[model samples]
Target: MPELPEVETVKRSLERLITGSAITDVNVLFPKVVKSHTPGDFKASLAGCKIKSLARRGKYLLVHLSGDKTLVIHLRMTGRLVYLEEKDDLPRYAHVIFYLEGGKRLVFADMRKFGHINLIPTAQLKNMPELKKLGPEPLGKEFTVQYLQQELRKRRTKIKALLLDQTFVAGLGNIYADEALHLAKIHPERTAQGLTGSEAAGLHHAIIKVLEQGIKNRGTSFSDYVDGEGNIGTNQYQLKAYQREGEPCSNCGTIIERKKVAGRSSFFCPQCQSSKR
Candidate 1:
């Protein structure tokens, strides 16, 4: 699944390619790919409407259009968005296509078919259930160290589990969670409420730092993720944890380790991130 930084990179890349391009037609090859609105309604609402802008909330991408309509997309797991020219053949897995005025098209392809599209009125974007329940953006001003400390106090769950909860902190997943915890030198099994004041502050900084670095690297591409231009990200080369199991830790000489937390695999350094209160 594309996490915060991955999704943000997609948003930035798509914005440059698709903005100002009017939708000439919309093709929904797989009907269920659109979670909200009928195919007919979805087509009617988007056709002829100009793309005003694009934004990302959590892992969801918002394609703001003229006439107050917004198209929300969640690239769950293997979903991918690509901008293709008229001569390019449609990808075999493409489930949705938005034809543009210049014969170009934005194709949404998903091998697992778990990706979704929701078309809603822009005025209701805030009240949209998915956007409504998401917690603060990790890179936003609202996510302060004080706020994190208070939220952590509300749960005895492992800090790694809490970080993966969208309602606890927006736009985090298995990859970045391990990286942030490793950066802060916190164990994945540590209870959220057991973090010391210094640990909490360090974690807050680590979260932002890792995420910023992720954007700088354009996001990790261990799987099918690609930007709008179909380019793989470079962050995979910069990861210190998360998939570096058995490798030496970047900060300490200890070997990096991997384990499952909440059914999700996690990577950390056992010596650097001791199981402590």
Candidate 2:
């Protein structure tokens, strides 16, 4: 899945490419992809509206448009949103296409078909169930070390699982969760409340560090992710723990290992991230 950094990168790219451009038409090839309004209503709402700006909340991309409508897009897993010239052939998996006034196209493609687009009143965005329950952005001011400590102390869930909960930290997925835990030297199976003050601080810093680095690299492109300009990200090369199982640890000489934590594959160095609390 494209997490916070990938979605944020797409938001930045689309903001540059399509801001102020009017939507001439909208094509919903897969009607079910329109999760909120009917496909007809969705098309009518967006056509002729100018894209005011782009923003990302958690893993969701917000397309602020004229006429007070905002298109909230979630690129769940195996979803790709790319900007292309009208002269280019459409991608086979493109489920939604927005035709811009300047002979450009913004395409939303998903192989798994789990991606969704929701058109909602911008004023009601705060009350929208999808956006309402999301926790503070990891990079935002609200996600302080004290905040993380408090949240962690309140949960008995496995550290990895708690981090993956959108309502807990917002935007952490399997890859980044494992990376943050590895960086903080916290075992994935450890209970959330088991961490010491120093461990919580380390985890907080690790979360911010990895996310900033991911955005700097334009996000990890292990699968279907791409920026708005159709470029794959390079963060995959910088990964330390996510998919490096059996390799020597970047910090310690011990071999990295992988196991299921809360039903998700988690990678860590046994020597660096001890199971003891």
Candidate 3:
């Protein structure tokens, strides 16, 4: 699944490519992909509306339209939103295609068909159930070290599991969680409340650092993630712990190990991130 960095990369690329372009037509090849309204209404609402801007909330992409409506997209697992220079052949899994002015195309392709789109009044965006329940963005001002320390002090859940909780900290998935924990030298199975203030501070810094690096590298593209131009990211080559099981740790000579924590595979250096808690 695409996490914060991947989604943010797509949002930035789409903002550059599609803002100010008018949506002349919309074709919904898979009706189930339209979650907010019927496919017919979805198509009718978007016709001739200019794209105002693009924003991202957690893993959700927000396409602000001219008529006070927002197109919300969640690219679950294997979804890709590609912007084409011309009206070429539709990609194999293209489920939704938005025809822009001047013969351009914005295609939503999902190989697993689990991705979803919603159209809602822009005025009601903040109060929507999906946006309302999400926790603070890690890159935002609200996610300070003090805030992280306080949150960690209250949770008994394992640190890795807590980080993966969208309600605890938005946009962190399995890959980044493992990387952040490895950077902080904290065991994935360590209880959140067991972390000292210094450990929490280290974790806060590590989380922000890893996320920033992920964005700088344009997100880890081990699977289906790509920017709006369909360019694969280079971050996968920069991974230190995630999916590097049996590899040498960059910090220590110890071999990286993988363990299951909270039903997700977590990779860490046993020497650096000892399970002392």
Candidate 4:
């Protein structure tokens, strides 16, 4: 699944490639991918509308269009957005295609069929069921150390589970969670409420640091993830703990280990990330 950095990278690329371009036509080959409106309505709302800009909330992509309509996309598992020239062949699993006036087409391909698209009024975007419940975006100014401490203080669950809660901190997935905790030197299984003031502060800094680094590298691409331009992310090469099971830790040379925590695979250097309580 694409995390915050991957989604943000996609938003930037899409903004550059698709913004200001008018949607000449829209084709929804997979009806299930359209969540809110039917394919006919989706097509009707988008036709001839110019894309104003692109933004991201949590893991969702917001394509602001003319006429107060917004196209919301969630690249759930294997979704990839690619802008292809007229001469290029459509990639396999191309479920949605937006034919632009400039002869370039934006293709949405998802092999798992778990990705989604919805057309909603821009005015109602805040009230959308998914967007309404998402917590503050980590990269936004609203997410500060004080904010993270308050949210963590309320949760009795393991630190790993609390970080996974989208309502508590938007845009963090399993990959980033493990990486952030490893960077902070905090055990994933430590109780959220048990974190000391210093530990929380370290975690706050580590979260921002890891995410910023991920964005700097464009995002981690362990599988098929890529930006809207089909470019692979370079952050995976920089990961220290996540998916580095049995590998020596970058800092202390301790062997990194992986285990199941909250039903997700978590990686950490046991020597470094000792339990706080």
Query: Each prediction's Cα lDDT score?
Result: 0.93, 0.92, 0.92, 0.90
Backbone clashes in model 1, listed as residue pairs: none
- TM-score to native of every candidate shown: 0.98, 0.98, 0.97, 0.97
Predicted model with the maximum TM-score:
2
Off by over 4 Å in 4: none
Error of 3 at 84 (Å): 0.9
Error of 2 at 51 (Å): 0.3
**Steric collisions counted per model:** 0, 0, 0, 0
**Candidate 1: C-alpha RMSD after superposition:** 1.0
- The candidate 4 region of ten consecutive residues with least summed lDDT is 268-277
Q: Model 1 has how many clashing residue pairs? A: 0
Deviation in angstroms for 12 in model 4? 0.9
- Candidate 4, position 56, lDDT: 90
Model 1, 24-61: lDDT tens per residue?
Answer: 99999999999887789889888899999999999999
In model 4, residue pairs whose N, Cα or C atoms come closer than 3 Å (at least 3 residues apart or on different chains), thus clashing, are none
| CA deviation > 4 Å runs, candidate 2 | none
TM-score of 4: 0.97
**What's the CA RMSD for each of the models?**
1.0, 0.8, 1.0, 1.0
